[model samples]
Target: MLHPILPLILFAFVATATPGIATTLSTASGAQFGFRRSVPLMIGSAAGLATVTGAAAAGLAGLLLAMPSLQLAMKIAGSLYLLWLALKIGRAGPPNLDVTMAKPNSFFGGAGIQWMNPKGWAMGLGAAASFAALADGPGQLALLLGSTFGLTAAVSLSLWCVAGMVLARLLKTEWQWRALNIVLALVLAASIIPMWRTV
Candidate 1:
């Protein structure tokens, strides 16, 4: 039997290193909202990653995959949500002056992106399935897989956000920030293709 913990470790490191829509959005969040404001988005992303990983480990993702109509539902919901977010971000008038006092963008921005991100689903499901296949025992494996993936996602995504924050200084203007957000939103919207194709 495979060393039970190795798969979790591999999943954590690999998932964190792989750039996904959440990474892009987190980077954008850090740039636009600063590291503090980006917290909500990051948290959201981590939650989404955990949810998917848990679902997969528990066999829910496989069931969802087997059900054609359910898969279609998820695709449609995710695609439309992305489109809505794109429109909202594009129309955002200006950054509030009291941004520092405002709530972090980590919650919705981070989490919402993960829910709509097909790549996230793929990673979570793939990792969980591989772990399940390798495991010799069944006790609490799902919990272990979920926790490992979730913690890794949070840490990994935070790094991306911080990198974005560090790079924000290079932008040097409000227009650049706005333009970046628009572009990121558009990218997020465009990422729905793989999910659509699968459906």
Candidate 2:
């Protein structure tokens, strides 16, 4: 049996390190909306991840993983969506940089994105299987997976927020921030190609 804690640790590290749409959006939100507004978005992202991982633990992910064509289709669609997001982010105008103008909808929006995210589903399924296989009991496995995912979300979102804050601090002008956003967007878009190939 695999060590339950081991899988949890793996999942946490993997989720935290992976730079996905959620991370980019969260960073943007933190930079544009401030930490308070970004919190909701972070919560939403976490919720979505938990939903998918829980589904994987329930074995739904197996059905998806079983079909190569379906998996391929999902990968393509996810990659395309990510590219679109990157483009949109790149083209967006600079924000007013006022926290009071911050839109909280971004948090829930990110959460919704996680549900349809191929990367998220793949990670969730892998973690679920790994945990289920090594767990001595269902309860222990659940606990481990939950804790891992929760911690991953917290750490990942915080890092994104910090990145945004750092950028905001460094770039004082609207044009500078706009330019940075474009770079961020392009970097995100470029990552999709490699990830798609790997998938």
Candidate 3:
């Protein structure tokens, strides 16, 4: 049982660390706003991941997957939000590197992204499905999966943030800043494809 569960933890780490909507957003946020302002986003993303994992353990994933309309709605809403965020990132100007002039991505915004994110759903569902048999009870299984996901997500997201912060130093001029923003925006836009396919 422990052996099997250990692999799931590794899976969570790999999944969260992989380039996806959440990681892309975290990187962009860290680059634009720095580490301090991005803390809430990281925390919120972890919380949201835990919530999704719990929901999956409780069998909500199947219900959501079965309902095509609900899945479609989520995909549309998530994609639109990502596009809006991309627009904001693209238009942003270089601010005082120490003091962010633009509003940073908030806790709710981070959580909301997970709520609508299809990859998040898939991860939760996969975790729950994979680990359900190891626990003594459904509640225990849910708690275990949720905690595993939450911790991995927090760590992985923070790593991405740190990467962005390091890269932020490269934007010496306004044009460099703009160019980085455009690239981030393009990456965000490209993420929509996976979301669309997941639904």
Best by the TM-score measure: 3
lDDT tens per residue, model 3, 18-53: 988789889988987888889999999888988888
In model 1, state the lDDT of residue 73: 71
Query: lDDT winner among the candidates?
Result: 3
Model 2 gets an lDDT of: 0.70
For model 3, the superposed segments whose C-alpha errors exceed 4 Å read: 1-4, 97-101
lDDT per model vs. reference = 0.68, 0.70, 0.85
Deviation from native of the Cα of residue 58 in model 2, angstroms:
1.8
TM-score, per-candidate, Cα-based: 0.79, 0.78, 0.93
- Tell me the lDDT of candidate 1: 0.68
Error at 9, model 2, angstroms: 3.0
Q: Choose 1 or 3, whichever is better by TM-score.
A: 3
Weakest 10 consecutive residues, lDDT, candidate 2?
97-106
Q: How far is 11's C-alpha from truth in model 1 (Å)? A: 3.1
Judge candidate 2 at residue 136 and give its lDDT: 65
- For model 1, residues 1-199, the per-residue Cα lDDT tens digits are 3475775787676776566566766776676578777777777878877777766677676776788787677777778876766665554423553243244454755666666555566666777666775555433556767778778888888898888777777766667767766786787677677667653
